[model samples]
Target: MKLDKVSAGYHKKIVVRDVNFEVSPGEIIGIIGPNGGGKSTLLKSINGSLSLIGGSIFLDDLDVSGASAKEIAGCMSVVTTERVKPILMTCRDVVSAGRIPFTNGFGTLKEEDNARIDRAMELMKIKELSDIPYADVSDGQKQRTLIARAIAQDPKYLVMDEPTSYMDIRHRFELMELLKRLAKEGMTIVASLHELELALSYCDRLLLVYGDGHVQLKTPDEVLSEDLLKELFDLSGDMYRKVLRSVRGEKEEGSTSFFVNRACKSFPCHDVPESEFNCMFCYCPLYDTEDCGGDYFYNDRNIKNCKNCGFPHFRDNYPKVIKKLKEKMYGSGSQE
Candidate 1:
């Protein structure tokens, strides 16, 4: 799919201009920037929801400008940020709606359609909620159901806006993984994301819509610079650096502590509190380290378990932890 010199927006008003890019099969592209940067408007242009003020979009030889709604629906599916309130409609019924383009005039589902719907629900892990009304489901569940609908549509390209907005951390991770799997299976995906980490980790390329109709298209690594991010979001210096460091796994010197306790009866919630038990390192700074040599394991839910690790509790280990953290923060043997 290709967009050439595209300018688009609501009726007679242009929000984004000169947007150009070609999407390859199986590539995942993420659109990101500050609010009102015309991300959604650009998406609308690609999906044919908003009319293009100038230029054109093409899906191979088929001109997007000329394609009928039904023809376009056959190749593209979109999950927008707009919440859909489905009255008296079950989740199954909602997912089945994706087949409208392929269904007969009366919208009857065939055996193949049922199989596709079943597969989509299973893929989204909403099979059990299929019978529940859409209005009764939680926001996260509803989001998943809508995603299931998109999947049931079986379009060659899938587009989503703020897909993870209502999802919990676990669901966010799961959904990204699912999208990656789908992309590997040859579906092109274009999405607008608020989570920079997820976008950096998942997208093959990123289109940054910095308001005033400016857009920059680049790979994640190319656009992950500190200055660009700070400018894009209008972040202050300290915060911009802090956010960058956190995402890059570089700990600031004072971000963690060695030992100190304010007022605590329990002192140690897991076991008897040692007089010297330090509350400073209550949350281990090295929790994110893969080979910190601490005795740690992940629980059933994949949460890190450091209950038996005495590395952070012992007062003497404070200096060593700090040293390791500093080393991680400022590379090994560099003046700290």
Candidate 2:
């Protein structure tokens, strides 16, 4: 896939400009930046969903700008974050839609198309839910079903928008792994991600889109520097320093995690049911310092027992953590 000096946005309003990148088969490219930085706009342009304001996009030898919808669908499959309210469709029905590009005008499914759907459901680990109503499934399950739908399309390129938004940490990693496997099997993948850590770890390349209309394609190592992150997200000096330290693994030795949480009783105050919610820290700010110094041991069941330390719960200790982390990163307050 190639984007040559592309510019894209809504209704003639430019969001991303001069975006040039070429990706090969079996590579995963991640588009990342702050909110409204044009990540989605760029993806839409590449997938031929949104018409480009300038330049051109080519999928191999085919011109994406001039291709018909059917031609584009045959070459590229899209999985969006938008929820599809399928009135009476089953999960199998959704996955089967992917075969529409190859189907006849009568929309009859061949045996191979059914086989592809079955394989896709199995790959997404949604075979059990294939017969289930799409409306009855959880958000994470719905995401997986949609991904399966894309997989069944068997397109050369797969595009997604925040595919991990509804997943827990486990399933988030699982989906990344699945995408990597699919890429290795010869599919080109492009997706936008808010999870910087996951993007750095999983994607072969990163496309940074600045809100000011600056865009650049670089490797993960080249794009993840402190200066670049600050510029891309327009972060403050303090926030950038803290993020830099965290990314460099320069935390206070004993501080495992630090977060302020509202102690709402109804908000999973005991255990974490999903990765989006951190119930462990709900009462971290109120823990008995004398009982726990913030150190804990995980037992066979992976249950935490932080009854000997309070290292991460002290709100007043943030400055100390920052100081220590900064010291570790830049060598004991010696400014660079």
Candidate 3:
């Protein structure tokens, strides 16, 4: 897929301008930016859902602007953020609609179409819900059913807007893994992601859309090393530092994870090294955990006393502390 000097927006107003990029086969291109930065507008332009205000987009040699709806649908499948209200349609019925482009005018499904629909449901792990009404399931399940519908289309290119929007942490990772596998199988994918960590880890390249209508295409490393995300998102110094650490999965110099306050009278609260003490978590996050990996004991009234625990204050225990907190909040298998 290729976009050349594309400008996209609603009505006559332009939201994103002068966008130029090309997505090669099997490449995962992530579109990331602040909210309302026209990521969805750009994607709609590329997918031919919205008419381009200027410039052109091409899928292979086929010009998107000139292509018929069926012609475009034959090569590209889209999963937009819009919620579908299918009246009385079963999940399987919704998925079967993906084969419409290849079906006869009467909308009769062939055996091959049925097979593809079933396979798509299975791949999305929604086969059990196939018979349920589309309106009855949860938002996450609806999103998965839509994704399965897109997969059932079997198009060469897949475009998605916030594909992980309604999914839980585990399902979000699962969906990204599935996209990776699909890309490996030669399906080019372009998606807008709100999760910066997933975008940094999974996308081969990022299409950054700035709020000022400027866009840049860069590799993940370039986006990180150049500090483009901070500028793009308009983050403060401290928030930017935290975002950097979160995406890189490494603690950098002057990281937000480590802090010290020496002015307090009880400064050396823990018996640990003052230089390595992290005051970020001044109060132990695991204080409520019954089996917290810390030196804690019950007081005379059976109330827990965490004053002797230094687990949260240790510099090296930041990740451990965060892990314990997340486990307490969302269970051990959670990724959020």
By TM-score, who's the top model here?
A: 1
What is the per-residue lDDT of model 3 for residues 62-124, given as tens digits with 9 covering 90 to 100?
999999999999999999999889899999999999999999989899999999999999989
Evaluated at residue 15, the lDDT of candidate 1 is: 90
TM-score of each: 0.76, 0.73, 0.76
Which runs of model 2 end up more than 4 angstroms from their true locations?
245-336
lDDT of 2 at 27: 98
Misplaced by over 4 Å in model 1 are 250-320, 323-336
Q: 1-336 in candidate 2: lDDT tens per residue?
A: 988988899999999999888999999999889998888888888888899999999999989989998889988999887889998889999999999999999999999999999999999899999789999999999989999999999989999999988888788878888999999999999999988777877899988888888898888788765368888888999998886666554222213354324555344333333433443454343243443344455555554435445444344545554554455557765556
Question: Any residue pairs clashing in model 3, and if so which?
Answer: none
Measure candidate 3: CA RMSD.
11.4
The model with the greater TM-score, 1 or 2, is 1
Q: Candidate 3's error at 276, in angstroms?
A: 24
lDDT tens readout by residue for model 1, 23-105: 99999999999899898998888888887899999987778888988888999999999999978999999999988888999
| lDDT values for all models | 0.82, 0.80, 0.88
